[model samples]
Target chain A: MAVDMTQKPILVVKDLNVHYDTGKGPAKAVNDVSFSLRPGERLGLIGESGSGKTTMATALMRLTRAPGRIVSGSVELDGQDLLKLSDKDLREVRLRDIALMPQGAMSSLNPVMRLEEQMIDAIVAHVPNLKRPELDARVQQLLKQVGLEPEVARRYPHELSGGMKQRAAMAIATSLSPKVIVADEPTSALDVVVQRQVMQTLGRLQDGLGAAVVLIGHDMGLIAQFADTVGVMYAGKIVEIGPVRQMIEAPKHPYTKLLVESLPGIEVKQALVGIPGLPPPLVNLPTGCSFNPRCPFAFDRCRSETPQLQEVVPSQFAACHLYPDHKELPPLPARATRELHA
Target chain B: MSKEIVRYIATRFGQLLVVVFVAVSVNFIIPRLLPGDPVQTALARLQTSGGAANVDIQAVSAAYRARYGLDAPVWQQYINYWGDLLTLDLGVSFANFPEKVSTMIGNALPWSVTLLAVATLIAFSVGSLLGARLAWPTAGRGIKSLVPFLMVLTSIPFYLLAIILIYFFAVVLKWFPPAGGVDTTRIMRLDWATTYDILEHAFLPCMAIVLGNVGFWALGMRSQMVNVLGEDYITFAEAKGLHPRRIFVWYGMRNALLAQVTALALSLGSVVSGAVLVEVIFNYPGLGSLLYVAIRGQDYFVIQGVVLMLIVSLAVLLFIVDLLYPLLDPRIRR
Candidate 1:
């Protein structure tokens, strides 16, 4: 894929692959995934469940446990290779360079402890040099930044509504002002209204920090709303990636085309062609393209020949046989076309 | 705040009173309902010894019935029993030998409470910490490998572990004495030296109880921690670039530990009231062992009174624990 010629990337992941060694065999959840984020840029990773979206997010944090290992990869944040860093060095990088906003983590806050205590504990952990009064002021400021009532800091997690909890989570996520923040499905579980509010909060926080964000979600509409770039994943590989507008307008990969069409808000009049069949089991995936079985364009060559992501246009990239010849393909099927009202 | 606490305490205490009354009455009535008079059994032993024994069985039975008010109608007996209980006059023990029922309890109470309370606290606190440590995925492979084995060990009964400890520490190694509290000779003087001696003697038994429960507590806490660690707040703390230890210890541990504390408190109360096997194995003069022997000897009044005391104590313990819930969990408070 053609790289942006001008920008210096703040975060770069190359050949990132994660696999779980289950009792049966190894399941390749993420395979040869590569992406880069420039300073202050927002990249959205969109995929269905088991599409390696979560795996990629956690692999960034080294959060996956033993059976699930990052087989081969280099996660470079601000030019430092995170994969090669020592545990202590990684800890430093995690706190000061890159942070993660974990999904559905708000309910886990200590009910017996006040929010101020929990938030202060976070500050103390990474930035121990702060004075007590400064710490208290920072916590109060954080609560305010997250749009919470100032007194919310003194309340327990359970006392807050779900949206408030997500805000609190975002506040903490941005607390250290790390260069890159990886948020995995931050708004997936929230109500529609709360979801919009939380997303806006995240946007505002990201804007304030000017930190690169890797927003992981399956919702294309959500990605369209916030993400500057969209990376469409299928069976553990980036099937398509480009500017969000370009990808939504002229998705080159069949997988991306289907995802954009499946979005509920998109003004498609015909019956939405739901992606037939579930995502392939990471273990014992089909030969050649993992999406081949469900790919309408699949043929003899598509079955046996593996497709690598290659440049399709000036900046767009896709992994598909139809785009193999580097020629502009026909418009997507009627059902895959974008609706004006979307 | 104080009003909520008072209401919480009052409701709990009132519930405890009802439970205690029910338990004590059940202890009194169930035995009476059984065929064959307890007094007859006592007299039967005397009769076997021949007329030279000179024990009047009928008079003895009448006195026994009168003492417990069993000579009255059953309903009247119950009402009178409650009347005596309200006045804190639980009647004289039919088998106290020389002391009053209340006096025996006074002497034994301290020993039981000290042993059980210390042992439970040690087991719960240490076990919970260890469990939390092992729950961390990054802690290492060695500890992770032990989780399954610990879970298997958790299934073993507490008494089985106690017996194993007794066999190794008491009978085999002989590092600690097999049973009883302190040297009987040293128990009379409650001096520092003797107190230390008493604690030393109780150590093996206390440790035995702790070992029996530590695995279970660890397993329980580990599971709770595993779930809590996945909570969004913990993730938020981590995202905030919170130190791993702070996220885990303060946020993760504190939240997950509420369940552990509740379980521990309930277990401790039950353990205090029902230390039967441990007391029997160690020959500690706890309430369980005392009541066990009293029933076997058919010491009717002593057994009844001790059972009532145990029931009441257990009820009170539960009440206190219930009251502590709102204090521990702010969400439970208004």
Candidate 2:
């Protein structure tokens, strides 16, 4: 689905930095990240494990616990800065204006509560004066909207299949018709067919509610199928971000290139090549660009200085020194650049 | 309510029956195996007191055995034991001659039940609340410091606490009576005055029990609360913007209390046995003191009766707990 670029974004996150005090030292989990989502737009956040995608999602809602904190950031929803709001006001905004569909459907819903009870809790937390019948009707409607039968609401989370649990989570998240929903790996625990069903349900829910979505996952293929725009992360930084089609077809960042190349294709017979090195430690990141240690295209400039995310194409942005506009620096080697673009 | 639940209850009841039978049989056999004879002991006590020394010892001994039915064969005694049990005849207490075993227990049972039940309920309620508070991430250091202190208190045996309390409150302060369930010298009426005196006398032993047990409940509940707090659903609850108080009670304590309920049920089931050490220390006329007396005097009938009562009561309590389990935890229903 297409979203109008002229519309004011429903959620704007600017320079979010989250750090964890791990006793040994501070580990930067999310470093200087910024993105925006227009209403009904699906932004996929794809990264390797521990690359801060989940951390970023938690920080957006101010859900980071002690020992880990949002060091600095501005998460503005509908022009109101969430970070500046008191906990009381933030809770008012949480489900009524923004909601989260968390990871691990099996553990995300209370095992002791019925699905309807959980949904009603979310509803009544925001709309306190609603009567029981009205609340029950709302829960049933949400369950139906998520492709679940009304009777499914009566069962506890354990009784539901993995797919049903994910769908129930989606139902609760969208129950209030919040303007933005952050879904972190909603389909990670399901089989392929159920994954497709959950994704489609998520798509339908987002479209129906006209809520912007930030879908976080490690599965590139799943992200590609659903994300209107894709952001590739390495270590704790977004290395490249662009329109999904453009980024997949022509990835500019070295990390994004490796990610795109690593997608296994059933139609095309090609041995999948993995990225060469582990993501740099968050505590003691490599000297220059976070991705430089593993980048085959890294040069002396890549090791000495960090590259800012600059527009490489009309709409795509990348953080690699090999991109044009680094004055007096030699261009990337022809053989390496050729091999990447091939 | 359902066929499956009914089946589960029936199975549990059957198991309870087996346990009760085994316990009753053991109660009958163990006292018989003891080396000393109760009738002989009684006669010796009379002789030591300079009374009945001139009487014919053999003739009296034969008459006593016949009167008490100890002259029957062992197998017949066993059969008669079951027969008397079915008819609710616990024979007569050898220590308190001519007094039925049932009457002695009947008099003592209420005091123990009242003391332990009130103390346990109070301890569980207060401890669980404090434990839930301590488990909160933002709980202050002052409250968190109670964990180790409470742990030390739990490690101290109930009897030790009883001694300490007795020394300070009874011996030193002289604020309350030193021992006994109630003052028999006072008018034994169901007046507020009598009730107040009974409670006043019960204060130290009850406090000792409460202080010793509250720590365990707090520790159990705090660990469970900590575990529940770490669960993903708690995070979800927070993300849902539920009130913090609601989150603490519904999301945190509700789930944490599941394991604790089973613990509470098991502890309560053993309440009939009474806190044996504390009772012995306080000289409280509860089952624990009764058991101690019966053992020392080799009062076989009294011992058998009390043990049987404890086993039957515990089995009944457990049966009720089993019925209530699925109600408390829905997962167990299946």
Candidate 3:
């Protein structure tokens, strides 16, 4: 798991903010958040629904549409500020420099086109000079690299299985060997066995291209296995982030601790532990730490003050008031723990 | 074409045959269903028009009955009707005897078909493109301004539009002729001069059809394009870094066109019916005008021929649409 310290990060996101303009008010989907990834690094971001995991992934690629605007921040890819790039420049950087493996693999491919044509669409958009035969060969190679047969090149998306379609999309995402791949729940629509295989393919593709990946998903177990570093997102913020082993075993933030324990256990035969309350509404979040109402350890300071992410332990960062005062996250009170409905 | 497509086409062709059979049967039965005898009606009209008030009225009526094969049983006439239809013999027009119904319709068919073909092609293409652009987030102000204008055009009937076009382009402006299909004084020839003259007269009627219909197509296509633009594939296409124009046509319009094609199929009947009014207003040398003249003269045979031709053409159009759908959407190939 040791990455070379001398290797400068391939991607850096600094204080990024994205807001969705609603009739009620601007919903702060992605609050000030920052993370960096070295070449060949994989960062898994896990959160509950509407936790800004997807918004942050899309904003990093500068693909945020109207109603959802990248308020202010810089997504620097190899020291180039992507936000300030012209439309032409941004298009050039996309697919060639960074690619997005979309979440809805079931519907992501254009239904009218053949599998080969969709791949060619991505390849030729970036490398327009390739000859027809060369493009055909390239598509075949990309598809085969993802464990699909060469004959799959002629099939339409509707003709392929869900797993095969997902792998085909993966083939297109990694066609140009981009510097960064933002995979937003690429396996969300697939079953477990297929999910594992797809993730492995994604990892192998990353290894081959030496690209950094920001894997966004809800399955903590899957992310923990595939990603070297894991970050926990809460109400538009990353509450805690550390190496995968420590983030799961010795989380520094109370939210991360509850999240890890909440994972259902098979051997114990105990009722599932549930986080008591729902996520806060984005438009009208509480005054202090967004999780205060749900945080069992909430105190006066935790209520009145919003904590910024700080390194409480080596290489571990957390946004919690208990940090720097208490060396470790305090144990959860037994009385406050509640069992989820079976 | 693949085997699946070929099979699909065969199925659609069968449907077309059924529709044609039903339409032809109805056309035959309609003439027979009239309250009065068609022979008496024709004779009465002829006498009024001074076609022979003195030439032995009873003998003339009996001769007419024998010429029309009305002397035979009803079943025999039905059998002869089918036999004649097989040979493309639609019988002679009562208003212009000895000029066969088939021959008359043949001359007029091209005009109506040409007008419909040219107008629909132009209107569908231009309106679809404009509508697709209007649905795009980056569509300019110039295209947006056409919305109100297109809506108004769609609301106006085609015949009304024909009158207005005649007034402005034919009467006031004198840029083109007001009525008819071509110059009356010139000898019809297959040359540029004749082509230009014919175009000059056909221009107003064509515009009436095109203008009245373009708005329906544009609005239909715009709404479809809007829905398609919101699909995940569109967003994925943008994420793939495709040029906006490429995405607009290949991804956006290409998908939206499936619905537009369906809409076009549903609207063809109305388009043909609407063109009837436009053709009459312009006095154009098309089947519509011929049908109008035949109806006034109670020329049952010509009316039957024209109606049959129109219904058959509509069936063919529907068949083409049915065969085309699976090509655009593979999911329907099954």
Query: Considering only N, C-alpha and C atoms within 3 Å, which residue pairs clash in candidate 2?
Result: none
What DockQ, between 0 and 1, does each candidate earn? Answer: 0.54, 0.75, 0.76
DockQ of 1: 0.54
Runs with alpha carbons beyond 4 Å of true place in candidate 2 = A326-342, B32-75, B265-274
Error of 1 at B189 (Å): 2.8
Tens digits of per-residue lDDT, candidate 3, A1-342, equal 346658999999999999999999989999999999999899999999999999998898898888899999899999999999999999999989999999988888899999898899988998889999999999889988999999999998899999998898889889999999999999998999999999999998898888889999999999999998999999899989889998998998888988888898878888878788899999998888999998889999988889999998888999999978999988889855688776
**CA lDDT, candidate 3, residue B21:** 85
User: What are the per-residue Cα lDDT tens digits for candidate 1 across B80-119?
Assistant: 8778777766554444443566677666777877888798
Q: Across the candidates, what are chain A's individual TM-scores? A: 0.92, 0.94, 0.98
Across B1-334, the per-residue lDDT of candidate 3 in tens digits comes to 7887788888888899899888877877776788778778767877787754554546656755765587677788878777888899887776676579899989999999898899899999999988998899998999899999999999999988999999999889999999999998989989999999999888889999999999999999999999998887887888899998889988999999999999999999999999999999999999999999888866767888888888999999988888789889988997
- How far is A45's C-alpha from truth in model 3 (Å)? 0.8
Per-residue lDDT over A291-332 for candidate 2, one digit per residue giving the tens place of the 0 to 100 score: 887777777988889888888887788888877854222433
Ten contiguous residues minimizing lDDT sum, candidate 3 chain A:
A1-10
Give the distance in Å from residue B255's predicted Cα in candidate 1 to where it truly belongs: 4.0
Residue A302 error, candidate 3, Å: 2.6
